[model samples]
Target: MRTRFAPSPTGPLHLGHAYSVLLAHDMAQAAGGTFLLRIEDIDQSRARPEWEALIYEDLRWLGLDWEAPVMRQSERLPAYRAALETLWSRGLLYPCSCTRRDIQDAVSAPQEGAEPSVGPDGLVYPGTCRPEAPPQGPMPDRAVLRLDMARALSVLDAPLRHEETGRGPGGETGQIAIPGDSLLRAAGDVVLARRDMGTSYHLSVVVDDAEQRVSHVVRGEDLFEATPIHVLLQRLLGFTSPIYHHHRLIRDAAGKRLAKRDDARAIRTYRDEGLTPADIRAKVGL
Candidate 1:
């Protein structure tokens, strides 16, 4: 019964983040399980030392404590690279040169019966790099590596299933079995390594969760649609899928998801306004 509160040190913690951390901490304490803190600073371009410090400060202010020294993703680049190499060796990864704009253009162009060409991971990759025959052409000068969903799924012994204790946007809950085709269509050829960063959220998260032996994954419901891709990656990499709890999001008055940019909702701002930990819990309906 191990749980974690993995937050990116890109901005100040908001009410939504506080809710997530509190929920995870409470669950672990109730079960007498371990609680861990992981700093997801993989996107170093946006990560800040001050932001990381603020995360610790905010969590401590919230009366949440976890085993440490905390794990930081930047320190684990070598491990992520190794995982990518392993997938590359197994022929489950291919270099993709398509950028967001290119994919948008390709998806926007009308094709007969394309079903609107949308996916959970943005516009379903148009497969611009797919070769017509074996021995695909030379890799592009600048390309990110993507998992070949079909090839990865081929090695699975059975269909993928995961336990869900929380609801999805469409009210999906309970044990869910993911069909191979549906999985691919929803998250087509998701990137494993970015051209600039060398690793991606999906690949790094799967590896980290397995390494940390997390028994339950608790996060915002907006990420529920991406769970199938995570489950698929877990199976492909021979790792266990953690029980998931996609809690409802903390939104603003207009129903907009709270973001780092929303400084008014930031925990630090509330603290500055003289709000106590108990007040925060009540405000978030914990």
Candidate 2:
């Protein structure tokens, strides 16, 4: 059993982060498994050296330790590009030139009481820039790459499903089978690589999890809707899907999800207020 706490070094570690990292550490310790830390600094535009240092300080202050030689995403562009090349060779990926405004305008409705459908990744892409057929030459540069979901599913033989060791926000559990059409509707032509960043979260995460040999994935429940996207990518890439454990989210008094911008609930702020590790565990009901 292997688990990881992959946090982006773009902001302070908050109560929600504390609950997640502590839970992952405790779970690994109980099972006598290895606990790993990976810094998700892929968005280098906002990632900072100071924030990365503070992540280490906060985790240590929370009475937790992880294996050395932590992985950082910024250093793995070649791996991501390699995966994209594989998908591109199979005609499962294509370059998309649609901007967010273009997608919204295409999918938006003019009639009253009708709003554009929203999917896991904001507005569902309307395939405005999707080519009628796969390109003949090499993959293009400086353009967003999107997966051809219909073509991808058509190439698969077996049914796509994953084990759920933890509950979802909607009580979805057990072996969840994902239908091809459902994925097409829910996450239509999801981006595999962005213009600025070579790889999107969906592509990078599944690759990293498989490379790390992670048997279980522990994360917030809000990401539950995106699990099928990862599962499909795993299938397309010939990787096994890990047991997903989506835990309850730590929210504020108004029942809103905690944001990284909310510094009042940051772990460093609590530490400055003289709170102990035990106090944090109790506060998060761990």
- Per-residue lDDT for 4-116 in model 1, tens only? 99999999999999999999999999999999999999898999999999999999999989997889889998888878777776777888778789888888887885764
For 34-85, candidate 2 gives per-residue lDDT tens digits of 8989999888899999999999999999989998889999999999998999
The per-model lDDT (C-alpha) reads 0.87, 0.90
Which structure among the candidates has the greatest TM-score?
A: 2
| Off by more than 4 A, model 2 | 109-115
Candidate 1, RMSD to the unseen true structure? 2.1
TM-score of each: 0.94, 0.97
Q: For model 1, what is the alpha-carbon lDDT of residue 62?
A: 95
In the predicted model 1, the residue pairs found to clash are: none
